[model samples]
Target: MKLAGLTIAYWCVLVMALVPMGCAWLAKAGQLGKPRRQGGFDNHNPRAWLARQTDWRARANAAQDNTFEALPFFIGAVVIAHQLGAVQMRVDVLAFLFVVLRLLYVMMYVADLATARSAVWALALLVNIAILFV
Candidate 1:
């Protein structure tokens, strides 16, 4: 089925906007906080301990930047596709993959799996490239 440029743009916007929301959810849920430690640890609370274990705030900030990082490419892809007179099905398919893969990337990042997340990120990058060339 054919998809509209406006529709794809809206979907991209929605996906990008959700990244920070997920991060905020994690922080609010205490998932981003410190982890529990055995005796002899300096920090008492798990949150504080986890904070010392890793710079989660920095990670979250990076995720935010990643989301923003996607914006230009996403917008450029749509604009290029529209200008190049690409088929709606082709554009839609790329758009769908880009959005889904990005969401998965964000989730994997939050979970701290670098290898798999990088693969997903690469896939999304390829999709963007495809859109630009198509």
Candidate 2:
């Protein structure tokens, strides 16, 4: 189904594109806004500071990295679904499922639930594959 003649699947594509921005923001959040002189939130040496993150902040950073890693496949799957003229409803559902699974994955990562997070990550990968095939 389309609103304003735009397939629902494309909306998911838009969300997928915007997701990287959220990941980038979350990466910055891990820095906690300390001055560069104090060894935190350094512009010139950001990765080094982020490398020192611990607890949930550290997990959040990892989640951001994982999120970025997932994006290319997810976006490609959605685009391929559209190109193949897959059923819009199925494509949209799978795309939406991928997004939900990713959100859960991120939360599980931050909570340090390794088993659950990995499970959710696997599920999201499956969802992306389904979108591509369907």
Candidate 3:
């Protein structure tokens, strides 16, 4: 049987959502970059830079919370779309948009760009709402 578009979209979302955690794991393992020492003269260590860019613990917590925040909307959209007999393409598109926006949101969050992140988040919310109505 052919897979539903929404199903595929959710799969993509699942994969994308794992990326940050993977990065975090690599960072923690010293695979990505080494941790920075304060007042150090060398500023070229990529791992150290990545580690110092943000609080990994806080980012992990925020990532988990972000996943929690979006999960319900993702589920609701899929269920409503399926129940309404909405076109598969449309449902998939909306779901894809949600995932993309959320991914962007995470990047923005990591970079500490609050305003841009919130805007992207709002767009994702709009997509979720549109899916519910569709």
Q: Which candidate's lDDT is highest?
A: 2
- lDDT of each residue in 56-82, candidate 1, tens digit only: 544554565687788788778877887
lDDT of each: 0.69, 0.80, 0.66
How high is the lDDT of residue 107 in model 1? Answer: 75
Each model's TM-score, in the order given?
A: 0.68, 0.86, 0.66
Q: Mark the 10 consecutive residues where model 1 has the least summed lDDT.
A: 34-43
Which digits, one per residue and each the tens of the lDDT, describe model 2 over residues 53-80? 6887678878888888888898888888
Output the lDDT of residue 93, model 2.
86
Alpha carbon deviation, residue 38, candidate 3 (Å): 15
Ranked by TM-score, the better of candidates 1 and 2 is 2
Whole-model lDDT, candidate 2?
Answer: 0.80
RMSD to the hidden true structure, all candidates: 6.4, 2.0, 6.6
Return the clash pairs for model 1, or none. Answer: 34-47, 34-50, 35-50
Order the candidate numbers by TM-score, best to worst. Answer: 2, 1, 3
Best of the candidates, TM-score: 2
